[model samples]
Target chain A: MTRTVLEVRDVQKSFGAVTAAKDISVAVPEGAVFSLIGSNGAGKTTFVNMVTGYIKPDSGSIRFADRDIAGMAPRQITRMGIHRSFQIAQLCNDLTVEENMLLAGAIHGASGPSFLRRAHDPEARDRAVATLERFNIAEHRDRLVPELSGGVKKLLDIAMAMAGDTQIMLLDEPTSGVASDEKFPIMDLVMEALRSTGVTVIFVEHDMDIVTRYSERVLAFYDGRIIADDAPDEVLLDPEVQRYVTGTPA
Target chain B: MRSKLFLGATAAFAVLAAGSVILPDWAMFLCAMALAKGLVCLGIVGMMRGGVVSFGQGLYYCIGAYTATLVANSFGVSDIFLLTLLSALACLLVGMAFGPLLSSYRGIFFAMLSLALSMVLYGSLSKMSVIGGTDGLNIAAPTFLGWAPEGRPLQTALYIYVVAIVVIAGTLMRIYFDSEQGLITLATRDNELRVEYLGASVRNIMTYNYVFGAVLGGIGGTIAALALGHVDPEFAFWTTSGEFVFVAILAGYLSVPAVFVAAIILELVRSFSNLYFPNTWQLALGIFLLVVIVLLPNGLGSLVGRRKGNAA
Candidate 1:
């Protein structure tokens, strides 16, 4: 078994008694494609927020690399080689694509000579080009983010996360709102990028095919708790996950 | 295109600075004051670019002016360089302490809260008669290296104006917005949750922004105090803060040079309004601002960028 990279124990979160997450516990091993599958309000986003230090759980401990990162702020956590992309592609709309990638690299504390061109430099133009090429949007590097289509924006958002030199990436519905045709390609590119970069991926996705295709391990969330954590086929076959997700086994 | 814009700004600054040498006393004075106000507006520009509006900048502005005025008047220390440095440090502390509180609020609430804070300082100053309260205190011409001005009022004002432009031009705060910290600042503006998830302390970034902004306001205030030769409680009024906001909107959230451009335009409006339409200049100014806002929704800075982009 791969060594565990993330551990969550008995985590609970509530907003004035409207419990968002309850007793959610899961472990993600290093270098694995971990998918957290859930319906709306299954507390999947909330759980992601908790692990990335966006939200502090009311009662629980989250350990990443054996350090309890229960209440740390997101930026501090980002400096530690973890990064996340928003569902809405939270990019600097006025900036060029290369600038966005450079900013990501800078945020992850990567800076040196030829910071914008060296292959290893996060801010290197080559790295941004590689990301844009991987996402099939290399032609739009000089363009502003606001001018891109929704699918392109989503792709660029993930590319920016890749540029950040992240060791662990938390992607929230990376394929959501994307065109049906572009979905698989984008997911393939993202999964391939993660595989090439050797970054541990924990993505929250709703589509079973995309999740099953990209994810090696699946953690099913139902009613704000993890109901099944196992291999993709096992989690898909689990009776509890089927009942909670689709009202029947797949 | 960006390089061209920077070049154009440098040229404009050169023209403005050179004009002071030949312009009339009233014209030079107006220009000098415009540059000073432009510097203050630059701080507002930075905050606004990051999607936070501060309506209380006058708090730091007033604090800066008072720090310099108090030391100069009470201790008879009139050194321009020392006074400016000391006052900026004082404003930096005030900004650091007060900035953290407003980092959590956004939109009108943040604006209003900042406005109220400045008003508090203004109110307190009015009650404290020792600081001359409502009347304010008069300051002598700043001594440069202990060399007293030889009754060269115009020359002295020109010197102050040059300093203001140089400081404003050299300011690299906007460049920081492009840095990692700057992206985080912008991220906080776009999506706080996403910024947090990226492992950045939104609050700390905000705090950092506030401290730098306060330093900008303090620098501007110090220059204005030197130019005006007085420091008053009115400097802390909400209207003063509002004026800075208006200037920032006029400049768009871009380079420091843009702020000066807007400030110069405003100064000309005030001057020409008083000159040709003295009776209704304020109303004319108000109408002009409305038109600018309506025409250039993004700001005058956007126009500048567009023109330069097209040219390039």
Candidate 2:
């Protein structure tokens, strides 16, 4: 059996009148490509946000490796080997792709301030180049992120997160803005590259085909609760899971 | 790239040295004043890179000027370079103390807080009689090493000294802005959240630049005090800080060189407008600034940058 890298136990979060998550418990094994699928406001994003330390959950615990990461800041969690990418890429618009990648590589290695270290030093530059090459974004090294296409920016966003030494990554809508035909290819590239690194990935996805094709384990959320959790084929074919997927009555 | 920058700096130094020898007294004096103010504006450019616009830089300027002036008054230490360096170092320590506190604020809040602090300094300076009070204090005629030149020789020597200091400081700042730490300031402005998640504390970086800028302002004030032969509470006034902010805006945050260009242009305009319309000189400046901002939101450096991009 694969060693568990992240375990969520009864994690619950709410916003006044809205419940974002409820009694969500799951165990993601190391090196597994885990995908979350649900309808609008099904608490998938909220779950990802909590696990990645963007929001403090109302109850329950988010343990990464062995330590509880319930109340940590995003930066603290990132330092502890948990990182996330936004639904829309959160990138420094004016910085070159290579600069952005080097920053990630530097952050991945050094826990302290990097005031004097050159961003294009041999190690960082080589790592950034290698990550870019993996994401098929090496040619856009000098191009500013704001100028890149949405598809390329999405890919670059993932590349930046991967540039770091992360054990688990929470990707919020990784393929949200990409064209339908391009979604599978993007996920395929991300999963394949990360597989070699032995990193666990928990991604929120909307496409059923891509979800089934890539994810070893699939989870479906219904009204802030995990209603389905199993192998992709089994979970996707579950009767209650189908109802949530199609937004139909029981 | 290093060789090219080195060559450019050498050529710049040669031109400035030559200008100091050949230029008329009035023009040389004007250039010296502009170069001093240019140092202060360069510091503002550094902060601007980190998404901050301070309106209290006059506080540091006041600290440097007053420190240098009081030292000269009480100790009779007249070596200009030594006193100036000592004053700048003191101001840097003061800046580092305030950096973390100031880094907590940004946008208009940061601007206003800085303005309020400088006003406090101005009020205290005006009330204190020990430092000359409302009459202000006069810094003695400073000597370089052991030589004290008077008349035209003094003017020429002072101009050459000021130019050398400005050139060396500006070159060092250029090297800094090109470094990894410097490039990260721009990124911090662009996205503070992303910067934090990337494992660099935004506050730490901002604090670093803030203290660095404060030191530049201090050096500017020291040079100005030495050249003008006076130090006053008026140096701590809001209007003084406003002029530095104005120059920063005009220069754009694109590069270190832009700050000097903008400083020179500002001095020229102020001199000309004051000569022709002394009462409405500020009005003239306001109108000119409006036009520039309307036409080039990124400041004049972007224009130069675009031209270079096209040439390349």
When only chain A is evaluated, what TM-score does every model earn? Answer: 0.90, 0.94
For candidate 2, write residues A1-250 as lDDT tens digits. Answer: 8898888998889999899999999988888889999998999999988987778998899888678999788888888888788899989877788878876776676544355555566776788888899999898888888778887898888888876678998888988989878887888888888888888888898888888888889899999889999999888778898887745444
The TM-score of predicted model 1 comes to: 0.89
What would the per-residue lDDT of candidate 2 be over residues B146-223, giving only the tens digit for each residue? 999888888888888877887788777766666567656877988888877766678888898889888988989998
What are the clashing pairs of model 2? none
Question: Which residue pairs in candidate 1 collide?
Answer: A74-B199, A74-B200, A75-B199, A75-B200, A76-B199, A78-B199, A116-A124, A116-A125
Worst 10 residues of 1 chain A by lDDT: A112-121
The CAPRI category of model 2 is acceptable
lDDT of 1 by residue, B174-247 (tens): 34643456655655666666455444566777777777778878877877887788889999999899888888
Best by TM-score: 2
Residue A81 in candidate 1, Cα distance off native in Å: 3.3
lDDT accuracy of residue B220 in candidate 1: 74
User: lDDT per model, in order?
Assistant: 0.76, 0.84
